[model samples]
Target: MQVYKAFFKIIQKNRGQILIYLVVFMVLALLLTNTYNPPQDTDFSKVKVNIAFINNDSDSQLVAGLKTYLDENANLVDLPDDTQKLQDALFFREVEYILRVPAGFTEAMLSGQNVQLEKTTVPDSTSNVYMDLLINKYLNTAQTYTTYLPGLSQADLTQYLARDLAEQSEVTLISNGSHSANAEKSGYYFNYLSYSMFAILILGVSSVMLVFNDTDLKRRNLCSPIRSATINFQMILGNLSFAILTWLVLISASFVMYGSFMFTPPGMLLLLNSFVFTLAALSISYLIGNLVKSRGAMSAVANVFALGTSFISGVFVPQELLGDNVLTIASFTPTYWYIKANNEIAAAVSFNADTLQSIFTSMVLVLAFGVAVLAVTLVLIKQRRVEA
Candidate 1:
């Protein structure tokens, strides 16, 4: 019927604008999903330890070798061998470990005597982890030198250990709890921002049109044979069709850029779950159109409200950084639900109490917002008709 015809007319009239918006969103989705360099270099700057040597010649080859090893691979801050300074720095949390080279260290090693060097470390400290790994690697390299020439000469063993230590590599752990392979926080950030920002733009404009036409032409259609309920239903169908159309375009772009990660249950679930926000958008648009007399005013109000919601809900940034108070307020916005759903999808393999609760809460809030806004729209429509 007439409602369907009116819907088609709107589509035909606005096809160019709609197509342009869809294209822009598609390009943005591709850009966001595409793999790119992380915000920082991949190299890990490891913490360095302090060493105080007694009767140790700083110019000795072994000392030079160890110094080079620390310089090239760690964040070494060289300090004098004063025991007072060393102990004070360590106690004050300035240093995690200290190395002590006793007198006759070089003579013992050169004379074939077994000399054990002392490396002091804090009982429990963050730097201890990296220090432990480095110490183990150095020890293993030392043992390997003992196997050289059936019995390694002290000088030869020192040389071999120094060479191995100089070339030792540092390891860093960047994880989000679960074993997600090479996933990074930046990829997740891009995905959610691209989806959410574009979704808001598309729905915001479409919602205005859907609401604006009702105020302008709905009364004329009311006098026709078609019932108001049927007209409203058809309008809903048209808006949903456009919403889904935009969604599919975005999904395709994401898939091309992100590969299989975009199709997993968590990822696709996020994309589909965002449709609830579209309903919320429609309802809000209805409220605005009913309250305002001009399309300009409606657009201004919608854009401002949409941006405000986007900011408060952490669509521009992750909600975790916003602290509890901002995050609590964010929970009431449909945009927050959409972004939360995306985060859950990114960490799908490690589903747990917090993420599951977030998913459930977001869906419930979106449904509630949609319902509340629709009820308001209905009230506005009734009052407008009564006044007329």
Candidate 2:
């Protein structure tokens, strides 16, 4: 009881720092969620890039058809044919791509000659790549038609290419209503939760553990009537209580911000992931608290451990965009699995056995990380006790 009382007393003494960390992170989370508004619907839509089209070639049905196709797939910017103006347009990001159709462009395609279409582009533009792919697809398909159908006229050629290109595969968004405004925001909160939760747990547990780690405090507790086991147990209880309270506050914030939507199935599972992650974070904090010999080291440990892992674990960035090597490295950390689970949880359109199995597997891996770290912490503590 004494150790437990002292544990929270230390927390109270350090309340200012704790409160600052909590408030700052919570505000940041809110701001980020507000700024990043994901689309409400999961419908597939092509990202149209701005392009400046300059037709050096004479008027022809094929060219008109090409311009119409560009219009359909991209945002064609009306820019003067001046070289300086086009360069400036690209430099200023007013256009992601530029196309200059040569005078014989249509004839070259009809003749099946290998003459390239002259083009300008914003350097290293992703949209430029897509535009290139699109144009190649059109030209290649048109050439194939011309080679195979020698008697086809230009108007007939344009008609055939347009019809062929119009065919597109259907895409279905298999998600569990994650596009709902509340669910999208909730997913963001959960992803960013790793950082704040890690920091707070580290701060809270380390503050208490640091105090108890003091040699004089340890000797005093040993000399007291309470057994070593009781002191350790009470300390564990205090740490767990603090961790649980912090978790509740965060969870409650989501519920408050999102209303009853938080009680939905996906939302509740999000809560479960956060809870498991909190335990792993607590174990990490315990290890850091014991290893770090002074209060001055706590801030460094918290920032480095919290922020570093957040960056590598798909908290700041997304797992989808992360490279395979980065993901492989991230897999070693429980934060990766936690975020991975959170992602799957949101995208889970159905709660069939297969989906649940994947989600539970991730959760179990996270818990395993916590249990393993706790075992290591116990071993370290036991070794120190023997030496003392």
Candidate 3:
């Protein structure tokens, strides 16, 4: 009990470092929440742009029909037939494009003569590109009709063009049949747990270990009446208590941000993956604590390992975008498997054998990593005891 109390007393002295990591994690969580909106799906819609039509030619059935077509596809703005107004309209973005049908434009098309229609728009305008396509679509279809059916009247051509262009096939967006959006949002939050948990656990655990490993302190503990086993058990309990509380704080914050998403099946799996990773983080902290003799060395090792592994393990960047050589090395680390599991959980909608096995296998691998590191740390500690 005394050792357990002492373990936390050492941590209280180092609370500033923990608060820094906690605040950083909170900022990161807020950013992730903003970035991962649930309604990522957007429906397809035809883009319509505002445009002005100038008919320099007398009204004819063909020109009238073309104007009608443009009206349907775009917002036709009316401006005074003045040069300044037109230029100002274009500059101010009130109109993205303008079409000027020159006199005798209809006659040129029926007689197989090419007439370039005057146009105005800003340079490199994307809306104008779509407008060009629309204009070309109508004229090109008109040209085809006149070439093959020269006897066809302008009225017939317009009628046929409308009918041909009117037919459209069905368009829709496909979905993954589950709460993929929510899963994705939660996934990002969990994926970020790696770096935060690693840094916090390392600094907290190692600092306490360093204090307890002080030579004068260790000699006093060894000579005390209390059994060594009780001290060791209390120390282990204190460390576990600290680690679990850290994990709970992070989980509670997520619950506040994401609500019941933290309790959903996939969300629960995300929690499980992160919990296993927390264990892995604890093991590494234990190992580093036993090895590093100074606070400065502990801080350096914590940052280097936490940031370096996060970079290679798909925390800062996705594993897919990382170089193959980098991934080959990262695969050796437990964080890589943890991230892989998070991604899989986000994409998954069902708990079929294949999906469950995939997620569980990743958890097992991460747990195995923690077990291996913890075993090594224990071995090192035992060797030190024998030497003493």
Candidate 4:
């Protein structure tokens, strides 16, 4: 009990450092959430492109009908027949397309002869292509009508060509039963939590363990009536208590920030995933404490492990942008599995066997890493004792 109390006292002394990390990360999470603003749904019917039309064709129903179609679909900007004004309009992006209907275009269409409409625009203009396709569709239908119905008058054909035949499609978006909208925000919070927890556990537990590893304290403990096994058990209890307390503080803060949403199926999976990662971090800290003899070295180890792993394992940057080689290397770390599982959870529609299986597989892999590190730490500790 005394040893456990002493261990907690060391952690309490370092509470300021732990609190600083927590506050900074929380502020960062809030800032990130605010920085990303999604645009509202837009009404496509209101969209109009500015276009310049030059009609050199003589008076005919077909030419008049084509001009009316262009006016209705686009904003027709009247410009003088000067090359300079037309070039300026295109350069300034005031008009997306300049369409010229050559002389005899109406006659060629009436006589079933091949005719071409000339168009000019700024290079690589997307709106220009859309306008071109619209013109082609209109003219193609007019050509078909003239070819098949020779008996119909030109006025009748023009009226038929001007009719709107576009089908209105209704789009309905469905949610996949997952909290995908909030998933990125949740991931940011938990990723930073893992980083802060790793550093805190290493610095807190290792510092206390160092005190116990002191030569005089070790000799005195050996001389005491208490068994070495009992002393080791107390140390383990202290470390475990500190780790659980740290995990709870972080988890609770997440809940307070996100509210009841944290209890949702996906959110619950995130919590469990983080818990498994915390265990892996604890084992890593234990290994580092056993190997490192000084507080300075332990602090250095904490920074390298925590920051390096976070950056490489998609905590700082998204996994989608990371290179294949980087992900392959990160696969060896527990943070990789934690982030990967979070991604899978965010994509899952329901709590099905497939989703659960993948998540459990990641958890198992994380536990395996912890167990392996702990086994090596135990062997190292036993070897050191034998040498002493």
Candidate 5:
């Protein structure tokens, strides 16, 4: 048909652009896929943390005992009596934790007064957790010692240790372990998703451009012998080709980056889900082209719709952060369904009858959207022909 011929001409002229876009997309996809390094599940050894303790009182025996205990279990450092130097070391992160003993720490412990031992450590450090466990261990040891003493009761020693030091021991955990490996992983995930969705802008722009192109060139085609439907069909095929190409690039990238052996058969399900999502994009793009006559105007609208919907749908950020209103609206977006499906597959959620049914639902919705767009475009063409 005349329309098919025209389409061939356009393809020949624009082959370069298609190739360039394909290559760029492929590279980006590979980079993202390669970055996905899942944490290994094993009993990993913990990092060593250095700790400094300053004894205020001359409790040589108590200090020696404590130092020996810590040195055996943890990396303990004895610092100068200078308080300012200890503070500087803490600020510099040279030590994971610092402990301070009052002037009468040893005397208080001997006098059966409640001794207040101070413990300091980097805030949120796994070291802090370990330190707490060690302190509890020391307490248990002291209780065992008291049980053997004829006159000393466990409570008596505990009270004496506290009163002698003026109060019970207070542990202060203080540096920067706020962000863990898992947190870093989350950041990477968000960044990858953000970049991936950014590419959707191309889809929007191309859709709008195609719409305007049809409106502008349609009159010229009407004068020729080719049926408009045939021309439209060619265009539709081109769009399908582009969508399929993009999906393949993404899947291939994942394989290249993670190694072909990483993703198993079930993992392939995520790729399939992503492919289904592309059909949704195709339908929406076709609808936009048929509805909008001005390329520039449609481009502007496309940007707004794509960005707004993607943001609200958790493509740009975590879906959990979005409130009920934004979340409720996001469900209507095709991107939401696909995103959800991708996540579910990644997490390896149980694949039951419900999941199969949901997949069928997604496919149905996408098919329906494509059919609607085709119907609308036909109606518009008929109207234009009648007017002419």
Candidate 6:
């Protein structure tokens, strides 16, 4: 009880550092949520291209139909035929495409001869390519109709083509039990939350260990009536209590931020995954605390482990953007599994064997890592005691 109480007192003394990390976690969560808010539903069918057209063809039904098609698909703007004016419009992005229907365009189409329309635009323009595709589709449909429906008069042909081209088909998109908008946001929030957990656990536990490792305090504790094993057990219990408190605080914050969504299956899985990762983090911190002798050295180790793993494991940058080589290296760290599991949970629509298997695999790996590090910590502690 004395050792446990003393351990907690050390943690209480470092509460300011712990509180700073907590505050940072909440602030970052809010900032990321606002910055990456999901886009609202939009009507894409009404989108139009901005274009400038130069129609030099004579009065003919075919040319008239082409003019109508261009007007319907694009926002037609009038600009003078002056070279400088056209160049200025192109340079300023006032129009995506500048099209010229030459004088013989109508005659060539009517006579069944292939003719190419001239287009002018700035270099490497993506909108220009899209506009070009639309133009080609309209002209190709008109040409095919003229070739097959030769019996129709010019006016009827033009009217039929216009009606046919104007028709639009409706499309509906459906989700197959995958993640929702809220789930995606939650994933990102938790991915970043790992950094806070790592820093708090390492700094908190290492600070306690530093106080216990004091030579005078250690000699006094050895002279006391308490068994060394009993003292060690109490210290372990205290560390576990501190870790649980930190985990609960973070988990509660997530629930407050996300509401009932945190109770969903995917959400629960995210929490569970984070819990496993927390255990791994605790074990690693314990190992570090045992190895490092000074508070300054402990702080340096905490910063390196926390920030370095966070950046490499996709907490700071998305996993999708990380290079394969970087991911390959990050795979050795627990944060990688933590983020990977969160991603899988966020993307899954329903809980199934496959989902369970994948998540469990990561959980087992995290646990394994914790157990391995804990074993090493115990061995090192035993070796140090023997040396003493």
The per-prediction CA RMSD against the true structure, in angstroms, equals 9.1, 5.7, 5.1, 3.4, 8.6, 3.3
lDDT of 6 by residue, 240-285 (tens): 8888889888878678777899999888999999888888999999
| lDDT (10s digit) by residue, model 2, range 99-199 | 99998888888887775887888778788799999899888898898888876798999999899999998777564543466666788789888888898
Q: Predict model 4's lDDT versus the native.
A: 0.82
For candidate 5, write residues 262-359 as lDDT tens digits: 25543556556566666666666666655665646555655676667778877666677889898888887766666555444444434667766776
Span of ten consecutive residues with least summed lDDT in model 4: 38-47
Tens-digit lDDT string for candidate 3 (1-388): 8999999998999999888888988899899888765764566678789999999988888898888888989999998778899999999999989889999999998886776899999889888899999899889999998888887898898899888877778877675466656687778888888888999999999999999899899999999998999999999998899999899988778888878777888888998889899989999899999999899999899899999999999998988899999998998999999999999898886778899998899999999999999999999999999998
Work out the TM-score per prediction.
0.61, 0.70, 0.72, 0.84, 0.60, 0.85
Task: Give the local distance difference test score of model 3.
Answer: 0.89
**What is the Cα-based lDDT of residue 257 in candidate 4?**
67
Worst 10 residues of 3 by lDDT: 36-45
Task: Say which prediction, candidate 2 or candidate 3, comes out ahead on TM-score.
Answer: 3
Candidate 2 Cα errors over 4 Å, as ranges: 40-178
Best model per lDDT: 3
Q: Estimate the overall C-alpha local distance difference test score of candidate 1.
A: 0.60
lDDT against the true structure, each candidate: 0.60, 0.86, 0.89, 0.82, 0.58, 0.86
Candidate 4, residues 269-311, lDDT tens digits: the string is: 8899888888888899998887788877977888898889988
lDDT of 5: 0.58
Please give the ranking of all candidate structures by lDDT, highest first, separated by commas: 3, 2, 6, 4, 1, 5
Candidate 6, residue 19: how far the Cα is off, in Å: 3.5
Instruction: Please report, as a residue range, the 10-residue window in candidate 6 with the lowest summed lDDT.
Output: 38-47
Q: Candidate 6: where is the Cα deviation over 4 Å?
A: 27-45, 146-153, 176-185, 213-229, 343-361, 385-388
